[model samples]
Target: MIDSCRSKADFAALRRGRRFDSELLWMSFAADAGLARPRVAFALSRHAGTAVVRNRVRRRLRALFREHADDLAPGRYLVGTRGAASAVTYRRARAELARLLETAGAFPRIKRTPT
Candidate 1:
């Protein structure tokens, strides 16, 4: 599945719905079993870094979502990077993102495969 997010209407739903925040990101989710499309908005403000740094942060965060989209709930999510995200590596970013999702209770606990 592709990580495609479009339209202001979808995002408006999340913002007006339930919300959660971590040091690394912000999440807005709602329980809609009726099926609303999944969407994401990333916020990398100028205060986060210079142009080059900001873009790099954006790329890394987008990649994390692209790779881990299945872990998220089907709703609008806005991942806003705080000032500290610029200093972290890609792997660290991934960990932070996972932690954020877990804290939000958005990630379902995965079953372990027995050898």
Candidate 2:
């Protein structure tokens, strides 16, 4: 299950973890050996936009993470965004987020051949 990073320490730890930037967002993630599931937090700064835009961005990020929570490695992940993120479509956000996750080694190595 995908859980929220509720503590300041956990957020700090993720902030210090692996960092990657997509066109629309920034992602920081660190693998946790002890974690039974992945935890995630979204940081939409005031500079990003107005309250409505920020909340929209937050909702999209959370949805993207939750939808793929089962595929992610056990870790603490934090996603942040700038004003540009507010303009992105859900499809683009998901695609970029997936790329970041893959680069962070969040997926298993299982492969399937083309039929």
Best candidate according to lDDT: 2
Per-residue lDDT for 29-96 in model 2, tens only?
A: 98887888898988887888888888898898889988887788888998988566578679988898
The candidate scoring highest on TM-score is 2
lDDT of 1 by residue, 26-115 (tens): 666653445544567777778888889888888888888878666566666677776755785898888878877777666553555899
TM-score of 2: 0.88
All candidates' lDDT scores?
0.69, 0.84
Q: Model 1 segments beyond 4 Å from truth?
A: 34-37, 109-115
TM-score per candidate, in order?
0.76, 0.88
Candidate 2 positional error at 73, Å: 0.4
